[model samples]
Target: MTAMRHYWLATAAKTGAVLADLPGLSVPKVKKVIGRYEPATASFPLVGKGVPVDWERILIEGATVFHLLRDNPNDPAHGIPVWGGMLVRPPRTEADDVQLSLQTAEWYFDGRYVGDKKYTGVGQNLIVKDLVESFAAAGPNGGLPIRVEIVNGGDGKPRDREYQNSDDKTLYSVLQELMGVIDGPEWTIGWEWQANPERITPVLYVGDRIGTAKPAWMPSPAAVFEMPGSVLSFTDDRSYGRGKGANVVMAKSSGQGGARPESTPMVAVDDLRPTFEYRFTPSTSIKDVGTLDEHAQAKLQILKDGSPTLEMVALADRGPLLDVDWFIGDDIGYSIGKSSRSRRQPAAIQVDPEGYAPASPVDGEGYGSMAGLTLDTDNYAEPAPDTRPIVPAYPRGREGVARVIGWELEPQGTPTVTPILYAPE
Candidate 1:
């Protein structure tokens, strides 16, 4: 029997005066809303109209390993050398969420003397040229490089120690020794170096190289993880037990020499879902127009069959508004297909909302809103809107009203799409 799975993913996009009340907030801060389940008397508001909230625990199960090198100095032939060090990743915990961490390390080796008759064990740490080359090779994509520096903490001045040849075998022995010192079960050894303050402190730096190309050691799929399934419904009650408030009217008159025209309430349809209920407090003072009462709540019924559906809800005194806005250019959609014996092939799909006429056809541009494209192997070309090109008739009535412009469905790989809808102006 095929197991039916349900995944709820909801994104709330808000617009209008409700947003105007907030100032200087980041996009994620202002638009994103997290939901929680609690008792009726809980201080936090409820989500979903007429439905009790339910909670599900999410867990992450993945690991990554990093390799690094350090310095060693005990060998007879080579003075100082680079060796591997420890592997590192974020520490997982039950109560806290784990975020990404950046790690880096550097290598330092002891320098040798050329003309001195007596061999002194004390020597300054010097950075080896190969160490730099190794880091560069490992970070071709410009990942944050571990800063490597050589220093001598011994009483001797910097000029007292002679630099060892790059090929010195003694350097290799020193590196091996350093690795042994830091080796352990939980840690993966990379390069190792001496920690004695007198010998020299090797400098190694690591961090998140934001917006930079990733190094080869980094995970292949850039995203940390992919969430599965679709969301059926969502609600937020933070403002007033479901983001409701009293309606207010604003009026103003303009006059230069004569009486000015009176301002009127903006007339527009306020669409609401019947399955959801909203409640708000009334405010006599204009300042309280958008203010919410201390508590809010909502209820919703989960679909039993659970085929997978996406739901989004926003609560506000002014009513819900479509949060869709194009930051880039016009929205478009495409598809890709691959067979066991060949490479993947991509195809564009056409789409059109029910009432609007098909846009002029372009060479490869799809014809519908970004959300209408169906997940299929056949490619569809997007039609240009300006030219008004003739196209196939769209399904009549409300059935053809909305189309999926772009969609993805991959069981083993990452499938993502940006769905956009247009509102009647």
Candidate 2:
């Protein structure tokens, strides 16, 4: 595969008209991030020492939208518009040099709210769809050309839960609170350009599970990365700090007449561990015992089985392609030094593909070197020793599946991605 050229394009936030191509003055200091819990964001420099006059005129805060597209190596005229978002605020500068920040359509939720609404034993997905559609019906200021998709049990049927938003909290916060419910759906604002209409469409995808878990020629599902190969360096910290252990948890919610209702403490005991208790008091808006108990149980579980964190810097263009091979909620398998059964969730990803290229010509080819190897001892040349390394022979440290929660792209000397991982129970 050939390297793809990446560039930014600007357009009108409301009308979506093609405006101008924005290539920064310098090497284009760019950074983009996608999170499971928050809206996606990006930042790039615009005016500097040698910015073109036309580029300078396109810096309208909150009105202009920018897209990061990767051009087809064979057809430069056509490009794949992968990630895009709106300019959330005014450009920042020191001494006349300017930089702009961006946030995806999801950011619009921060301004819209689900005022005076309450749902009792409602499907989580149904609530999400209803809230989003309500905003879209509000016209230009709040309306967006988004298609709502609910899959994997997010259709307001089965898996019922309770939700109440009387204080008029923003849609963003409401969704965050709803999705944080145990076993609730995952979500993302995915984008794609349509040919017939010549426009970019945002897909508000919500589901019980939102990614692929296919066999990747490894002993596990999802893409696998081994040290001394795709993996570069990693850090493992099992210290249960900050989110300390709490075997006993008490949860409380708001009650009638300015009073707060509380739940009996949820306890988990082990003969070998000491007791650590804490109280969890959520927002006053939450006023149901069922909800409070759920929160309490979830907290107690976390405290009982502390989550360890694992992070690593690996080649971005290796193992799997973003969106295609792995998505925001997909599980990724990685081995550091020895293969031990473990699982981690990707809470964040930072990609800095600036000053570096693939270390070897054999990388980024959609498949690893181990993809085609097979056992054919019969065709043997006792002498026909397998040309590939034994699949189990590669050095593997801690090995387990991890869910991708977020991703980032920024400037670094080498093209790499650092994914923040959290051990999941």
Candidate 3:
């Protein structure tokens, strides 16, 4: 019989976590532990307690750290994990701890946002995919830990219609909020990515609510147990007199220029659940006091959840000239709007405004047809199989991809491809 040597599933350096394995371990031992993920934790293993028995047990207040499993522990950074995310707190834990969990990097996103931004200009779905792929791309432990679906059920209603300003609510906050919204009869989100696919998301029975969803070495339930979903859990001896709950907060964008987001990108939908297969440029305006730059320039064809046409209507610019329906001009045609804005049955009370954010900006670069027509790249591209490959999906420019990959508060983030390769085939 051998004691299983200890190891973490992933790195917490990106975001700090609490170490619960061996509480009595001293400063040196703890430092060895903390060094596992992040570089610094000025405020970590925040301890406070009222433990019973022999001595007051200690509680290390920090995130549960995970990182790629290294072949060499001395320089563990080189190694990576196939799948590692903190549970923060197991299902149905004591009332004291709050669960600040992290899902797998593989993710799926749908829904409109302020310019459909998950970051600055990239769509949320794209960003999440990039992240998962990045882990697969680390120097040593590269490649997806395993193929897992990262699911994001974004809010159907988008409040901030403009990517118009650099100072809008952040994508990090939106993602955090998104997780909070999934009311769970299904608390355990899409299965934690495991190296093994045959393993189903296990059921955590009541009581201790311990261990992981399922640990690999775990004995087959049928052999030693009856209920497939139940298991008594055990935790490190950091036992205390009065137990506290776990409430973890995901990290925000780090401002250290080195740590700041390299770029901002995310997508926005003027309408919920993209209605049209084709998407145009957002309203990227440049009026000095204007909001066109803030506008994703994609156009506004959507309405609120259940508003009367008059309650909240998508109208054309009230400017002197008429707003252009690029969708129709290109022969893409309208979806059935009585007016240029709304396809919903229009009413006398509803008013469609005038003027438009020209598909071509007030500026001249948009009209540069020689070095090339930079205008509306989203809707157009050249034929492929030659110097350039054919791209059929809607395009999101470099800025948009950068926007999506940008992480807050961490400058160590890597840069992305310019003019992103459409859907990395």
- Measured by TM-score, the strongest candidate is 2
The digit string of per-residue lDDT tens for model 3 on 95-184 reads: 543233333322211111222333444343344334333332222523222232423333222222223225443332333322221121
Q: Which stretches of candidate 3 lie over 4 Å from their true place?
A: 8-168, 180-425
Q: TM-score for model 1?
A: 0.16
Question: In each prediction, how many residue pairs overlap at the backbone (N, C-alpha, C within less than 3 A)?
Answer: 49, 8, 77
Candidate 1 overall Cα lDDT vs. reference?
Answer: 0.21
Question: How much lDDT does each candidate structure score?
Answer: 0.21, 0.58, 0.22
Using lDDT as the measure, the top candidate is 2
Q: Which ten residues in a row have the lowest lDDT in candidate 2?
A: 359-368
TM-score of 2: 0.73
Worst 10 residues of 3 by lDDT: 398-407
- Model 1: per-residue Cα lDDT at residue 138: 35
lDDT of 1 by residue, 1-425 (tens): 22211111111110000101111111111110101001110011123342222211111111111111111124422123221111123345553233323121221122221121212333212222233334322333432223443322222212121223342423323232222111100111122223332121223321111012224464221211111112122211112123222122222222333343322332222222122233222111112111111111111111111112221221211121111211111221111111122222334334444332223222222232334334344553343454331212221100111112111111111222222222111
TM-score of each: 0.16, 0.73, 0.20
Please report how far candidate 1 places residue 252 from its true position, in Å.
Answer: 20
